[model samples]
Target: MVRTVLVLGGTAEARRLAEALAEAGDRLRVVTSLAGRVSRPHLPPGEVRIGGFDGVEGLTAWLREERVDAVVDATHPFAARVTASAAAATSALGLPFLVLRRPGWRQAEEDDWRWVGSVAEAAELLPTVGTRALLTVGRQELEPFTRLSDVWLLARSIEQPNVPIEAVLGRGPFAVESELELLDDHDIDVLVTKDSGGDDAKLVAARRRNIPVVIVRRPPSPAVMIVSTVDQAAIWVIYGHATVS
Candidate 1:
């Protein structure tokens, strides 16, 4: 018998999990869903669907109609709504559910960092840290930083901010030296980012230059089975399906 799985995917971890499941042959049937926010996302394996499943009610009905045996939410760490919806919908149906959340970054002794509760708070806290800044909080949250217009800003985003910004287009896994050069070239006095961790280059670059950093912490997620990597999630799915079978 084949096991049907639904992966709420948009993160790097999500793509990896889908790849691992794809290697498991016909024993597992995988369908990966994307929010369609990114214009050109890194496509995952197996079956793929774009856009939301409306909301919780819509998702619950879809699960019932599709006969999905398990669900894994591998959305971006900041994607709190999708995560909550997945948790609620799966719990109601007694379906197996898991979240693949990459671990967050830690501040070290050499780092000068201020932890803010939200994006708005991070914007408000910026003036205390430095006068010129680079906002790496992604494109959506760029609006909050506009209030700090007095400070020279260099923002990075794959999509352009609606408002006029000194924006740079790039993705992560940045090299520390490359990050340092960008900062030094722009005369950036601070770096603002979310604590959604993967590579440490940009944060480390700030530390090397003695530039202050304002990090917006992640929002609380709904209680669920959370794992940190693709391997762990894959193991859980295989083990879970075996146990149920």
Candidate 2:
């Protein structure tokens, strides 16, 4: 017997987990859903679905109609709303749900880290830290830094920012050497990023340089089974499928 699985994926782990499920063979039919935010998102292995589903209600409806057996919340760490909605939707429908969050960056002995709860808090801390700033918090919240005209910003994102604030467009998993060069080129004095853990190469580079980073906290989710790696998720899914079969 085969089971259908829906993976809410936007991170590397999602892609990996999807591929793992595909490798597990005909016992599972996997579909990975993307947010359709990135202009050119890296294609995940197997069947792909893009765009939003209104909200939790719509998602619950889809799950029931599609007869999806399990759901994996493998979105970016800062992607709070979607993850929360997934938790709620899965719970209301009594579907097994797992959250796959990559580990957060660890601070070294020489690193200077200032933990903040949100992007606004990080923006407010800019005045005291440095005159020149590098905001890597994504394009969506660029508006917060626009009000701080006194500080020169070197903002980088895949898409161009809506509001004005020195923006750079590029893709990452940037190399450490390249990121260091970017910091030096922009004369960056302070770094602002969400505690969006994972293999975000640029954030790792900043940490290595002992740069002061203001990390935005991750939003809380409803109590559910959580796994940190794709491999773990695959095993769990296989075990569940076996039990049901």
Candidate 3:
């Protein structure tokens, strides 16, 4: 028997899960749904849909209409809204669902990490750390730092911010040497970032330079069955559909 699965895709893990499901054979018709935040997202294999399903009601209607057998919420860790909505919609229909989460970074003994709740809180804490800062919180939410005239900003993202910033356009998996050079070149003293896990390039570089890092904690995701790997999610999808049917 054939099955159709909906994967809420945005993060790298989401794309990986989509690929794994696609390779599992034609028995599983995988559909990947992107949030369309990025102008050009890395398209996943199989059927792809973009944008929101409005809300929980809209999503439930869509699932029923499409005859989705199961769902995998593989959104970004920070995407609390989408995760919560997925949980609600799936629970309403009693559909099989799971969260595919990539683990966050843990602070090492040598790490000079100052944890904050949000970007605004990070901005408030920055003055205590350094006057020159590297902000890796992305271009969308640069509002908190705009008012800080004393502290110089080095904003790094895939796209540029609307507000004037000392910008560096680059992607991550950043080298320690490159990070060191960037810090040295700009005389950067503090690093600001979201707790976007599965990477440690900036954390290590900051530690080596004795740079204080102000990290914004991720918003609370809906409490649900969470798995860390694509294989784990795939197994859930396979077995879940069987159980549901």
Per-residue CA lDDT of model 3 for 1-245, tens digit only, reads 88999999987788888888888797899999998877888899999999999999999999999998889999878888888889999999888888888888898898888989988899888988899999999888788899898999999987778888879988666888898899999999999999988777888889999888999998886677888877788878876533221
TM-scores of the models, in the given order?
A: 0.95, 0.93, 0.94
For TM-score, the strongest prediction is 1
CA displacement after TM-score superposition, residue 41 of candidate 3 (Å) = 1.2
Q: For residues 105-202, write the lDDT of model 2, one tens digit per residue.
A: 77667678888888898889888888888888999898888889788998889988888887888877778889889888877878888877775666
Structure candidate 1, residue pairs in collision? none
The candidate, 1 or 2, that scores higher on lDDT is 1
Candidate 2 to truth, TM: 0.93
The positional error of residue 216 in candidate 2, measured at the CA in angstroms, is 1.2
**Model 3: which ten-residue window has the lowest total lDDT?**
236-245
The CA-based lDDT of model 2 is what? 0.84
Model 1 bad stretches (over 4 Å): 241-245
Q: Which candidate is the best by lDDT?
A: 1
Per-residue alpha-carbon lDDT of candidate 1 for residues 34-123, written as tens digits (9 for 90 to 100): 999889888998999999988899999999999999999999899998988888899889999988899999888999989999999988
Model 2 stretches with alpha carbons more than 4 Å out: 207-210, 241-245
| Model 3, global lDDT | 0.87
